[model samples]
Target: MSVLLEFTIRSDQFKLGHVLSGSGDMRFELERIVPTGGHTMPFVWVSTERDPNEDLPRFEANMRESDSVQELLALDRVDDGGLYRIEWEGQPEGLIKGLAEAEATVLEAFGDRNWTFRVRFMDHERLTNFHNYLTDHDISVHIIRTYTFTEEGARRRDFGLTNEQREALVLALQRGYFDTPSEVTLDELAEELGITKQAISDRIRRGNEKMLRPLLLSSAAR
Candidate 1:
């Protein structure tokens, strides 16, 4: 299940205007689109159920909210699957016309130097907990798809991720949280986030089973 929202913002504003807030370089596939007008623009978007932080608990928490997540959790028979709604309220005429004429819309794609390029999925605390865990232990737990159990979670407690080990992987690749070539050590990350090393390890391990096994190790390892 995948969901995405894309638009161009020439200035710094929110709601009526585009919101751009990201860092550094990135590599993305561009599937050209021919806009058909009215909320229909050419763009590519994908969705997954893995913990953005590479932790099950955190992933689970995020699942409860986040409208874009509706597809992923709904696809694999998610137990205690959450309920959400899609709403589209008519906007005032003036605001709508203003965005259609933003100056920055001439860009070829999302860029590091762009005035703004912000995108986000639903983020939950359980997933946050998992991220906190990996950072505390100083483990470069590579990508590995596997099934793991934490004292919490429903039956089977297994699923698929879009091939990302942890949120850090995205951050590292995109240069979101890192400013230098050196990777953010796990121990330092955990301390900054204030979580135990073992807890982080457990969350990362469990996260592997949920959809990130490809991240830290082999699928069998999880």
Candidate 2:
């Protein structure tokens, strides 16, 4: 059985996060990681609300000065952000190393200040090993939740919803947010989850769309 883990790590604790501190309000979403020789190269999308033309140069300059970054290549520019590939000077330590050692697959990873990651490990043993590796490295990580997926569970959880979305939807259902009269309000849900009401609302809305889209499409085809 595969185990899915959701955890949070402080920006200063992770190498990439430390390098990206220069990005100001920019957010990074890791596209993929490539292992070369002894180093790992990460391709990430840099997003910011400010003008990319004005910020990109500054961000690049900051990254270049970082000891962890050996080479930075601008891949492409999108409407909201640009993609860049970074080559580390040496082998990455901490989370990346632990993930590689445990052979865990990064499902989702993105953020600034604090990064939240959803990773999948092959089994319970691999998850244990990954945790042990992080502990030995003295990497401080807060695990939000873990789920072991069986075949049936995987099918049920396979809607395009993210972990946050799924959690929001589940809590909403449990608290009668979907009821006609509504026993719970968005504020309550957000408070319970330690997030803003707007965040909770967005998750529920997006989650509903993700879960309903496939079913509605299939039914229409039928």
Judged by lDDT, which candidate is best?
2
141 Cα displacement, candidate 2 (Å): 0.9
For each candidate in turn, the TM-score is 0.20, 0.70
TM-score of 1: 0.20
lDDT of 2: 0.82
**Top of the candidates by TM-score:** 2
Give residue 111's error in model 2 in angstroms. Answer: 0.6
Off by over 4 Å in 1: 1-12, 16-35, 40-99, 102-222
lDDT of 1 by residue, 1-222 (tens): 111123333322322122112211211211222222443222321122233233333434443344322222221212211212211123222222222322112212322223223222123333334334435533222322212233112322433222333543343345433456556655554464465444333334434554543444554686
lDDT of 1: 0.30
- Model 2: which ten-residue window has the lowest total lDDT? 148-157
Query: How displaced is residue 106 in candidate 1, in Å?
Result: 5.1
lDDT of each: 0.30, 0.82
lDDT of 1 at 25: 23
What is candidate 2's TM-score against the reference? 0.70
